[model samples]
Target: MRYIVLFLHLILFSIGNAQQLAGHVYDKNTQKPIEGANVYLDGTTLGTMTNKDGYFAITAKNKMPNALVFSFIGYETITVEDPFSYDKNFKVLMKEDLIGLEEVVIGSPLFSRKKMLAAFKGQFLGTSKSASSCKILNENDIVLHYDPDNHVLSASAENPLRIVNNYLDYDIIFDLSDFGVKYNFNTLEPL
Candidate 1:
């Protein structure tokens, strides 16, 4: 009888100790809830998005040591090292990443814009078999620039790139924070 009582207590204790991170993401300047913000454990596929109310909950269980990443397009990504430190309904304030549109244009007369984009996509998305089936839904949103003198190419996007990976059966909303490819000095080829 005593062993049965101890087993019930252990079960309840374990249930209570389950690690669940719950919080609301908001714009720091506006103090408004940030809907659709990606909340996930860094270096892990476990993730969830903030609801319309900016509320999100992710169960990490034994994975509390991993940093929790809060990401949304146009906002600075936030990483919390100790998510367990915060109580439920924790407020995560994210600041906007100020990127001027005029600055995206680093034009080089040597390489055509179309060619630069193709190069960017090649390096950004590898030439693997799975990549063959991947498609960028919003190619227009991508901004590319090349510097022939330096043999360097850079790319950025104002919005997240919607990618359809038919081979993987996953729709990826990739926020291209920054991308660049530099050519090998001797080969003059993208390295």
Candidate 2:
């Protein structure tokens, strides 16, 4: 009887540990439910979209230290660190991202568009076997800028950058918020 009781307790503990992390996302200003919001554990493929009512639930297998990221188009991304420590169902408020819509005007670039594009591709997509098979579907949507003084190459796109990874057999829609690569000024090599 003692052994059976102990076994049952262990099973119950395991079941409790498998409980999911759930939450609702809403707009800070409008207080309306945000549908189609991206909820994911940062750096992991475990992701899900919010329902029409702004409810989202993702399996929390273990006590993860990763940040829980909430993102959507035209909204400021929110990151909650140590999500496992919070209540099972919490509320997330997302603010509007107004700056993303502002137009950026650039003067004459030091390098040609073609050259800048090549550099951007090489740095963004690495020089690996699998990277060769990957292609950016919406290259035209990206805007590349090189700051000579800072020795940095930056890329921005209003729409999500579409990527087709033939090697991995995956179509990725990446919402690029920020991207910049620093290089050695003298040798023109990535730092």
Candidate 3:
């Protein structure tokens, strides 16, 4: 009978079979949906492409979690799993990789200028501000030899920070500004 056959098919299909997952992929940088992107498991043949609308849906034959690798030209590759990070369909969010930074070194140095250079060097070597054993000069040392070009003793021995001459100037101005008042002062010495 037709009813019997249909019922039998339904019973067999319900025997712990697979389910389809559905969702969309988006580009975080352009704030637009990405279409026609490739989504697939790392070591398996299971995969699909985003629709014209950046939507996707696919069922995993296996009930296990799978690493889905998504890729598109001009964008970073996206890897995703189901809500539980396995063999299930789910939405994915991808971010752009930033490629630039702006850096500016301000002011000069003090204590032979080379000492200030040593301080900056210290920062790179995991030296704490309160470190007592910091070696500025020793068997393996950094010396502050006078640079004729810049008149500052530095590792380069030339072209010292101009702020060195105005060290007290910066301090005087900053200290006065802390009073919630603005008064011009010429030097670090009390006027």
Candidate 4:
């Protein structure tokens, strides 16, 4: 009988220790709930987005109060500590604002315009540079060309370099638009 009582007490204690926190996110100025905002319990996979009404919920895994990070495109990211304090109904207010300055863009839609432009132009940092261009062929191979001094870069892939998975990166530090185009610039060994 005593063991049964102890078991029940342990179960209740664990349940109380692992309290759940849930809430909605909103724009502090708009006075409207934020929808589709990412709400994560700090370093855990326990995350979800606010509903159309800016509502979200998650069970805390530890006794320590978890911080909730609310993020969305355009609006500034907001963080909440001790989310469980407010009766599990957390409210987050974020200020809407622009992110980019000058000619720099922080983020964009997948397969976005910036990505399209950079796909052929490439990314640059200091003295590092890379770029590429390709021509559709009638066969099964891509021919690539790089003429640094002559200013000519090109490639022709017959099969389109098909594979299960592929990874690509670039580093562009100089511009040789006068030379032509590159099919793909990969390595830049400093000479």
- Clashes in each model (backbone N, CA, C under 3 Å)? 0, 0, 2, 19
Overall local distance difference test of candidate 3:
0.52
> Between which residue pairs do clashes occur in model 2?
none
Q: Which stretches of candidate 3 lie over 4 Å from their true place?
A: 1-7, 10-16, 81-89, 97-191
Tell me each candidate's TM-score: 0.50, 0.48, 0.41, 0.47
TM-score-wise, the better of 3 and 4 is 4
Residue 31's lDDT within candidate 4 is 86
lDDT of 3 by residue, 70-188 (tens): 78766778766543344444667666655443233354522434444444344323344434333323213333333334433223211222221132233111111111111133211
Off by over 4 Å in 2: 1-13, 100-191
Q: Across residues 1-191, which tens digit of lDDT does each residue of candidate 4 receive?
A: 99999999998888888867787788888789888888887887888988989998877656455677889988888877876665777767888977553234345423333333333333221223211232212223433344444433443332433322112332222222232353333322221
CA displacement after TM-score superposition, residue 151 of candidate 2 (Å): 24
Give residue 62's error in model 3 in angstroms.
3.4
Candidate with more favorable, higher TM-score: 2 or 4? 2
lDDT by residue for model 1 (60-131), tens: 655466788999999999988877776756789999999764654444467676777777878989879998
Candidate models: Cα lDDT each: 0.83, 0.86, 0.52, 0.57
Q: Per-residue lDDT of 1-191 in model 2, one digit per residue for the tens?
A: 99999999998898788858898999999989999999999988888999999999999667778899999998999999988888979799999998634456568767777887877778888878888888999999988877888887888887999999989899989997788888777223555
